[model samples]
Target: MITKILQYYRGFVRARIVSHSPERFLNLCRNHQIILQDLVYRDGYYECQMDLKDFQRIRPIAHKSHTRLFILKKCGFPFFLYRNRHRKVTYISCALFVIVLYVMSLFIWDIQFEGNQKYTDDVLMTFLHSQGYVQGMKVHNVVCEDLEKAIRNEYEDINWVSARIDGTRLVVKIKENTGILEIEEKNYEEGDLIADKDGVVVSVITRKGTPMVHKGDTVSVGDVLVAGTLEILDDSGGVMAQHRVQADADIILERTYEYNDYIPATYIERNYIKERKHYFIQFFDYRFQIFPVEKKENTEIITTKNQCHLFSNFYIPVYYGSCQERIYEETEKSYTETEAKQLCERNLQYYFKNLKKLGVEIIQNNVTIKWDVNGCTANGTIVVHEKAGKLSQEQQVEETMKANEYH
Candidate 1:
């Protein structure tokens, strides 16, 4: 690839040789250290490509080998410049573009982040901006080591961070601490565990409190599942003393989620007519249109912009691309019964998928879809088993005690 690029930068040519001693001609050319590429022999003639400099030297060798050489084609940058020598404005514009790109390369144009899960791109970018490490800042102003350390310090979840400048882009890669961090257990005030939703109790495992509800019991929201107070019974079945503690337990419950959705029978569909192509160039905040675009009603404009870049990660502020104006007509349409049913089923499946994401185990789905002349309706319930318990301040209960019981 390097050699081909060098050849193009200098110049190259394809020449045809008609000689009886083709083997001798090749040997002489090799002896002179002239490299020939894509050599082919066809119909008693030899054709090959050589650099322009090598082509010039091959003339003497061709004479010595009693061969006739004819230049078939000229290629490469030198030839291109010579052909366009008369166009002064084109050359001047190209030179100015190169200068502009060189200037743009001195500053950061793009910021990219990778290997991020807990922190999103916007969040990370916002942090960087707060630290004065934003796009369009001078490349020299960015200290990679400082940026890496700052990120790791800012986000406790991120254990490792790598920041580097690739061309004009600043790339940051981070590895989040996936392992759960252990927290010191603190003595919490006495509280009771209550049901946050109406459900049937599936199971209860009391760790540090008295269980108030058993399995198969139907409970409503705000009902206490575990009591924070514990009572000590005497041999005669009398309350000897009472101990109050915070409730701690794992409780599972089966709950039902009502699902209801309806879709209108009529919808508007777009009918495409034709598209008009437009060209534009943008430099920083200013944009220039190559051609005038006529304003039309009921037309959608879709634009694509491409930033100027010399290589990967080396982006410039200048952007150029095309815009397509899509002309379309809206038509009113009605959904068929089959289509409505399918749409309703799709919505139902999507709801179930969201429920499963929240660690809810689906037990049963009793959804029914009905299609009528007006529209489609899906109404039913979904049964799921999920963890159920929320901490609530314990209600103080007054108890009568004799002074002798303390002794």
Candidate 2:
């Protein structure tokens, strides 16, 4: 295989030799160190293939053997170049295409987002555009670490972010701040733990200070559940001294709240059609789609962006892509009783999930779901038991006075 390829590159010739003694000619050529391949004798002629350079050296041997050599074919890169040497435009166009493709690959062609929930692609891209990270810009101009840092700093809800380049595509990943609760800070100054809302006290655990309320006690908003001041009693049961400290406690309260939800049976929904228009824009390290005209009301538009490639996954930063805006028209959609019920259940699940994130424990939930030809409604009473106490901020002057008194 390797020999055949080398022979083709160096140019090879297939020739027919008219010789009375074909076997003697072949032996003489071999003895002269001439490389002859595919040698065959047929119809009173010797046929064989040899390198173009060796073909020239064989003329003397053919003459000595009294054989007439005629080239049946000449093929290879060298022959092709010689055949098309006069076509200047073809060669120039081929060279320019390769040079252009190589130059385009040095910049970004596409931007993609992953693991994002609160921030949309448009929002993230807009922010990146402001940072001079746009599409069609050289990859060397953009720093992945700096881009991640900028995104995290601008969006407080993003807990972590990453930026990376794959081929000509710029990939951005983000982890939003969700579900996790903030840690409570420690306060050394005197303060009281008061009821955050009016509810029945289900349970209480005092970690510091004194508990002013007990289980089954009904409290109102702003009422102190735990007192921050401690009184020292004398032998005669008289107050000897009083000291103020920060109160810390967990006070779980049982509360009932009304939950109501309504979903219309006949709703307007968008029906997308195949009609599409494309618009492309490039920023430094980011590229996106833009609408040339104003979008239609009550229509749903879907846009898809892809990295442009020169050939066979060989992507280039010069994006030549289109945004297909699938035009959609509003249509009336009717929901059956079963569908309405399913929708209501989904909403209830979402609501409960959010409540659980706030550390609320559901003690009882009695809900009623009803559906009609017009719509569906879900009404219920949710009884949750949760911590009802929060620390009240102590005034600056009072804190100073307390500190002085303690000293």
Off by over 4 Å in 2: 1-7, 21-33, 63-65, 114-120, 152-162, 173-307, 316-345, 353-361, 366-407
Question: Global lDDT for candidate 1?
Answer: 0.88
- Model 2 lDDT vs. the true structure? 0.81
**Model 1 worst lDDT window (10 residues):** 178-187
CA RMSD for every model? 10.9, 8.9
What does candidate 1's lDDT look like per residue over 1-407, in tens digits?
Answer: 99888989999999998999999999999999999989998998989999989988888999999999889999999999999999999999999989988888899988899999878998999999999998799999999999999998899878789999999999999988653433344455778888988999999999988999999999999999998877777776777777777899999999998999998899999999998899999887688997756667989888888888778888877789888999999999999999999999999889888777667899999989998899999999999999887777656555545233543
Report the alpha-carbon TM-score of model 1 versus the true structure. 0.53
Q: Which candidate number would show the highest TM-score if scored against the true structure? A: 2
| lDDT (Cα, tens digit) per residue for candidate 2, span 171-206 | 888988777556456765888899889899988898
State which candidate has the highest lDDT. 1
In model 2, the Cα lDDT at residue 271 comes to 75
Model 1 lDDT at residue 4: 82
> Global lDDT of each model?
0.88, 0.81
